[model samples]
Target: MSTNNIGPKRLVVGAHYGLKEWIIQRITAVVMVVFTIVLLVAYLISGGASYEAWAGLFSNQLMKLLTFLTFLSLFYHAWIGIRDIWMDYIKPVGIRLTLQTLTVLWLVACAAYAAEILWKV
Candidate 1:
């Protein structure tokens, strides 16, 4: 008995997250860019030249929601990119998992802090 390891009989193995992650990264980036544009327009329209003016700009419920969502998108974007880096560069499974875990924890903390500060405005 024999086995073939070339041509169409070749077996390929990998932890591939090819298309889905690519699409997610693109969507998240677009969301962040659109949010930035919206924020800039809002600021410009409001003439946010003072502390009170800045506060007033963010005081609206819609603005607060959009800000929170943008923060979440930013965090998720960072997480995906960092996770991919760890997965690609760190060959050891334990180290990669540990780094991914730490990344998740840090991003979650940042998102929570962002929410708190955003709502306070």
Candidate 2:
């Protein structure tokens, strides 16, 4: 006969991406900050709010590549955050899947649009 009381046997589970996602999010944030600072410095030194000034800034090959990288980082950061929101609040599997699909489609479309704009400029 064994009599040891444990409160209803706890179960612990996880998808195991918590720390990885957290670290990636921080890295993405730093990338965005650096991009913003670069843009700000360019703007200040250029000393013009004209469309031509801005166009010249992004017309450089290095600037274009950096801008694309920033775009990618921003999209990935948003995806992780939004996915977390959907996972935490939405309980129904079908509804969650639908939201996730919509989010992915929207993000992809935005990426395509960004590509078009970046290349055009």
Candidate 3:
């Protein structure tokens, strides 16, 4: 008797992140673009190129919140892209995990620094 390995009988593999990760990447990109536009507008309207004017722009509480949110989105976006790269190209499980761990640590540190800078503004 012949057997077929298709459809429900076929084994499914891979990261299974096609739709979800694609959506997240797009969303993060949009968030970053919006933040950039907002920052650009604010900078243009600030009407000065001095250090004090730049500081004053970030000094707003609303801007600070938006900045932090953008940073978070950026970090998350980086994480997803890097994680996918490691998963796809790194064959060794141990090395892939190590790289992923380091990526997480670096992104987290950046996020912390971002928060500190934003709050200090």
Candidate 4:
């Protein structure tokens, strides 16, 4: 019995990447929680019974900043999840690469558009 004849050795070692991913996910989760709470509170305060009221809430500088941050974090988290899925299940190298590239481009475009709109607020 020999190691070489058994199989290729695992290249990944230590917990650095896993730990980083976990930390990022948790931090984004917290941001989402806070953003949701604040958004709900603002909506409740505004009553949301009229379009004007909702518009007024969104027009605030603080609200715009929070909205931008929330979207950014959400986009990043989604990108990470999609990348992980592609790496885990996609067997074909060319197909996986294409999917990953498209995913990244789509996410980036959406994030940029969201940021631009937020900036106008």
lDDT values of the candidates? 0.87, 0.91, 0.91, 0.85
Best by TM-score: 3
* lDDT (Cα, tens digit) per residue for candidate 2, span 45-73: 99978999999898998998899889988
Clashes found in each candidate (C-alpha, N, C closer than 3 A): 0, 0, 0, 0
**Using Cα atoms with residue i matched to residue i, what is each candidate's TM-score against the true structure?**
0.86, 0.87, 0.88, 0.82
lDDT of 4 at 93: 97
What TM value does model 2 have?
0.87
lDDT (tens digit, per residue) of candidate 3 on 14-116: 7464789889989999999999999788778987688998898888898899989999999999999999999999999999999999999999999999999
Candidate order by decreasing lDDT:
3, 2, 1, 4
For candidate 1, lDDT tens digit of each residue in 30-55?
98999999978877987767888878
Backbone clash pairs for candidate 1 read none
What local lDDT score does residue 81 receive in model 1, on the 0 to 100 scale?
Answer: 89
Clashes of 3: 0
